[model samples]
Target chain A: AQRVTQPEKLLSVFKGAPVELKCNYSYSGSPELFWYVQYSRQRLQLLLRHISRESIKGFTADLNKGETSFHLKKPFAQEEDSAMYYCALSMIGDMRFGAGTRLTVKP
Target chain B: DAGVTQSPTHLIKTRGQQVTLRCSPISGHKSVSWYQQVLGQGPQFIFQYYEKEERGRGNFPDRFSARQFPNYSSELNVNALLLGDSALYLCASSSPGTGEKPQYFGPGTRLLVL
Candidate 1:
C-alpha cells in the first residue's frame, strides 16, 4: 500500500517570500509523484509531475527517494499561487493523495 | 474538447438506498477512475477502469461497485448507502497507454445522505 502525507494542513506566507509545502510518501518500489492545485471556485489541476520535472507557475518539486519526500517549493510566492495543494503517489495502477495543504499568501 | 463530465451534479439519498453516478471521460481517454472525497479531506481511490476492464480497486467494500462502458464512460453504484457515504464522488480520466498521463478530474457529484 502507498500513502502520502502532508504535514502542514495550512501554510501562510508573505507575498514574494519563499514557500515550501512538505510531502512524504511510503512505497516499496519506485513511485511517480505529482503536485495538484485547486484555486478557489476552480477544479483541481495538475501543477507538475516528477517525471516531467517542468516548472509551472514558479512551482517545482523534486522527488527524494531516500527521504521519501516530494516537497513543493516556490522561490517567490505570488497571491495567485495561494490555493490548496495535494501531493500524490502513483504506483502500479493505483494512485494515492495526501490530505492537502492550504496555502495563503498574505500581502 | 470537453473535460471529464459527471452527471447529477448533486444528489440526495437516505440510508439503505441505492444511487448511481455517471461519468463521461474526455475525448481519446481510455481510462476512468473513481474517488470519494469527504469534506475537508483528500480524495480516496475507489476504482479504476481501463479499456472497459477493472484494472484496480481501492479499500472500498463490495457495496461499492463500478463499471466502464465501451465508449470509456463509467458509473459508480453504491448500494446500502450509509451516512458516511455522503461525499463528493469524483470521476477522473486519463490516457493509460500514454504512460504516466495525468488524470483529469470532474467537478464531482455531491451526494448528501440525510
Candidate 2:
C-alpha cells in the first residue's frame, strides 16, 4: 500500500535555528510529493511540490528517490513558520497524506 | 477568482442520523474531491468526481456517497452516522487533464456526531 510517514509529531526549534521536517514514503511507482501547511485559524494550503522544485517562504524540500524521502528544510526558522505541516503523495486517482508534524518556532 | 466553497460551516447530529454536505468548485475547475480531516490528523481522501462522473473513491463505507452536478458542484451524503464520523469535511477543486495539479481546498464543514 502507498503511505506517507511524518515521524515527528511535534518539532520545536528556537528562532534563527535551522529546521528540518522529515518525511518518508512507501510507494511502488513514481509519486508526486507535496508539502501542505496549515496555520492557526487558516485553512490548509499548498506549500510546494517536488515537481516544481521551487522554494516557498524560504523553505525547500528535495525528493530523494533512493531514500524514499522528501524532507522539508529551512536555513533559519521564523516564528511565523510555526504551523502544522503535512506531507502528501498524489497517485493517479487518490492522494495520501501523512499524519502531520506540528512545528513550533520559539523566539 | 473565488476559491472553492462549502456550505454549513458547522453541524451537529446524532448517531444513525443522515447528513448531506455540499461543495462548489472554483470557477473553471472541472474536478471536485472530498476529504475527511480528523482533529490533528491529515485529510483522508473520500471521493473524486470529474465532469459529472465518479473518478475515484477512498476506503470508506457504503454509507458515504457523493455526486457531481452539471455545474461542477457536488454533494456528499452520509447515512447511519457514527460518533467516529465526526470530522472536518474538506472539499477541493482542480482542473482536469493535467498531471497532478495542485488541489485548492475550501473552508471545511465541521461535523460533530453525538
Candidate 3:
C-alpha cells in the first residue's frame, strides 16, 4: 500500500522568511507525488506536481528518490501563503493523501 | 470553463438513513473520483470512475457506493449512514487520458450525520 506522510501538523513562519513543508512517502514502485493547498473557505487547488517540475506561487518541491521525500519550499513566505497543505501519492490506480499540514505565515 | 461542481452543498442525515450526493465534472473531463475528508484530516479516496466504469476503489465499506453516468457526471450513495460518515464529500475530475495524473476538485458537499 502507498502511504503519504507529512511530519508537520502545524508550521508557522514569519513574513519574508523561508518555509518548508516536509513530506515522505512509502511505496515500492514509482509513484506520482503532488502538493495541494486549500485556502480558507475555498476549494482545494493543485499547487504542484513533481513530474511537471513547474514552480507555482513561489513554491517548489524536489522529488528525492533516494530519500522518498518531496518537500515543498518557498524562498519567502507571505500571509496569503498560509493554508492547509496536503501531500498525495498516486500509484497504479489508487491515490493516497497525507494527514496534512497547517501552514501559518505570520506577519 | 466551469470547474467541478457538487450538489447539495450541505446535507444532514441520521443513522440508518440513506443519502445521495451528486457531482458534475468539468466540461470535457472523463474521469470522476470521490473522497471523504473528516475534520482536520486529509481527503481519503473512495471511488474512481472513468468512462462509466469503475477503475479503482479505496478501502471503504459496502455502504458507500458510487456510479458515473453516461454524461460523465457521478453520484455517491451512502446507505445506513454512521456518525463517522459525517464529512466533506469531494468530487474531482481528471481530463481524458490523464487517469489520475492531476485532478480538479469541487467545492465539496458537507454531509452531517446524526
Candidate 4:
C-alpha cells in the first residue's frame, strides 16, 4: 500500500519567516510527488510537482528518495500563503494525499 | 478553459437513500476521477473513468457505482447512504499519461448524509 504522511496538522509562522511542511511517503517503486494548495474559499490547485522541479510562489518540494520524504519549503512566508497544503503521491490511477497541513502566517 | 465543473455544489441525503453526483470534465480532457474527502482527512480515490470506460476503482463498496458518458462527463452514484458518506466529493480531470498529466480539481460538491 502507498501512503503519504504529513506530520503537522497546523503550522504557524510570522511573515517573512521561512516555512517547511514535512511529508513522508511509503512506496515500493519510484514515486511522483506533488504539492497542492487550497486557499480560503478557493478550490484545490496544484502548487508544484517534483518532475517539473519548478517553484510556484516561492514554494518548492524536493523528492528525497533516500529518506522517503518530499518536504515543501519556502524561503519567506507571506500572509497570503496561509492555506491548506497537501502532499500527494501519484500511483497508477490513484493519488494518495497526506492529511494536509494548514499554515497560518501572522503579519 | 472552464476547468472541471461539478453540479449541485451542495446536497443533503438521508440514510437508506441514494444520491447521484455529476461532473463534467474540461473540454479535451479524456480522463475523470472521483474522490471523497471526509472532514479533516485527505481525499480518497473512488473511481477513475477514461474514454467512457471504467478504468479503475477504489476500495469503495459495490453500492458505489459510476459511469462515464460519450461526452466524457461522469456520474457517481452511492446507494444506502450512511452518515459516513457525508463528505466532499471532488471531481478531477486530466489527460492520459504515465507521468505527463496533472489532475485539475473542481471546487467539489459538499454532501451531507443524515
User: How many steric clashes between backbone atoms does each model show?
Assistant: 0, 0, 0, 0
* Candidate numbers, best DockQ first, in rank order: 3, 2, 1, 4
Q: Which docking band does candidate 4 fall into?
A: medium
lDDT of 2 by residue, B20-113 (tens): 9999988999888899999878999999888888888999999999999999999999999999999999999987654258888999999999
For every candidate, how close is chain A to the native chain A in TM-score? 0.97, 0.99, 0.98, 0.98
lDDT of 2 by residue, A1-107 (tens): 99999999999999999999999999999989999999999888999999999999999999999999999999999999999999999987789999999999999
DockQ values per model: 0.64, 0.71, 0.76, 0.62
Model 4 C-alpha lDDT per residue in residues A1-107, reported as the tens digit of each score = 78999999999999999999999999998899999899999999999999999989998888999999999999999999999999988877678889999999999
**Runs in model 2 lying further than 4 Å from the true structure:** none
Q: What tens-digit string does per-residue lDDT give for candidate 3 at A33-96? A: 9999999999999999999999999999999999999999999999999999999998655789
Q: How good is chain A of candidate 2, measured by TM-score? A: 0.99
The most accurate candidate by DockQ is 3
**iRMSD of all candidate structures:** 1.7, 1.4, 1.1, 1.9
Give the Cα error of residue A82 in candidate 3, in Å: 0.7
**DockQ, 0 to 1 scale, candidate 4:** 0.62
After superposing candidate 4 on the true structure, give the runs of residues whose Cα lies further than 4 Å from its correct spot: B96-100
True contacts kept of 1: 0.51
Residue-wise lDDT of candidate 1 within A1-107, one digit each (tens)?
57999999999999999999999999998889999999998887889999999999989999999999999999999999889999988865688999999999999
Clashes of 3: 0
Tens-place lDDT digits, model 3, residues B9-86: 999999999999999999999999999999988999999989999999999999999999999999999999999999
